[model samples]
Target: MKECPQQNLIVDYVFRELDTKTKTEFEAHLKSCQSCQQQLREFKAAAPVFQKARRIHHPKRPAQNYYKTLKENFYPSMSLAQRIHEWAADFFLTPSIAMRVAQAVAMLVVGVFLGRFLFFQEPIPVAVKNETSPILAANVSDQFLRHYLQETEMILLDVANTNPAEDRQILSSVKQLAIYRQLMQKTILCREHAEELNDDVLANLINEIELILLDLCNTEDENLIETLQNVRRQIKDSHILLEINSVESRGI
Candidate 1:
């Protein structure tokens, strides 16, 4: 069977990340996919308004409890099967092309998650016209932002926990590039919202996360393995995930 390049391109389109030729091609097919058209409409409707939300978190928002939990189970346990799979995987795939392979494998592996909605469906549900209630709009925007952050936390946990390869190891055929790209867009939305509202802590952590995510999207391989390892360490070292966890844990 032939493949649908539009699948990946659609996510890019919703985020306004596509090139002219690709965007033109996607629109040509998009005219036929009623489902996609509906999704795109919702995406456009929810965006700019959410970006304008002045207050993303309330004054008496929930406090952090996960910081203690994080300190206790800093390196949470992983299942034996997952451990074996990752370990054996390291042997078969080499360093140079790990990302390329991972990109291919990720497309298939993450389909269950992305296919169901993440990649193809419209994620933002808020309407632009209802921006009259600033608090409500901010809450809605924060909900989506939390969802994106949690997903990224899980992916980073896997990348961090997976057994390290000496030179070239981890993150190949392991997950899809489209997934990170989607997360990147979400993070951007979250970061912009965070910055505009003077939420410095959230903005800073998101900035750190964006750095790693961009690397994942670009697959920069100069010090590839080391870079990934550093990303893992940074997650813990910078305590960015912990901070995001704190915000999310308190349901902020």
Candidate 2:
């Protein structure tokens, strides 16, 4: 007897709707066809949840007019059956937008509960002004030194995975990193010496420079090497500015 066409057998084989003889023949064909094997995997993954959703019973079908009203109001572009299928699929696939919205609301509620339980509150503001003394500046400089060391250690720890050529590029950028670290220290020292001088502006600038250094340290793309060089030049300019200011103040 002539064998049945593969396309004719696909849907029946997928749903296990075939008789013993047909199923045996289909299995024989499936073993040799990679495409059919992948299709079977997708169908197997989707089938159980679809079967469970089909088992759920409602009292009765809604009125045609009610469905018409809903379709007109919310889903003018989709048919009623498509909308129902979408809702059922989303219910089974937990990462759907509806599930995300519910998760967000639940998190917000938990955050409020924790705030009440822990008695947590906002931070107090610190005042700053110019004419700060050197002693306070030195303390601020120490804090910056500690931060720079921590960041440098993190970068060095990951150095083994870096390409030799890339490492050389990153090494050239080290002078920029050094300058940034020095500026951070000086900014801290200035803040300590002049309690009335706010450090927020300088701190933000230093943070931007730190982010560039971090990118250079972490990235492996050859295309990004040029961009890192450009950022190094910018950092050098900032360091020069700091040096010029320090010199002028000292009458150098």
Q: Which tens-of-lDDT digit does each residue in 1-252 have in candidate 1?
A: 244445556568878899998899889988877666766677678876877796577543353455556766785666899888877686456434876677778778777777777567553422331233233334437667777778988878766776547424335432355566667767777887887768787788789889878877665446567667777777778777687788777664
lDDT of 2 by residue, 22-132 (tens): 899888998887677766777778878798898776644667778889888997887789999888787657577878888789999999999887996643311111223
- Which candidate ranks first by TM-score, i.e. highest? 1
Residue 33 deviation, candidate 1, in Å? Answer: 99
Collision pairs in model 1: 102-172, 102-173, 106-175
Q: Each model's TM-score, in the order given?
A: 0.40, 0.22
Q: Global CA lDDT of candidate 1, please?
A: 0.69
- Each model's Cα RMSD: 40.4, 18.2
Deviation in Å, model 1, residue 218 alpha carbon: 2.7
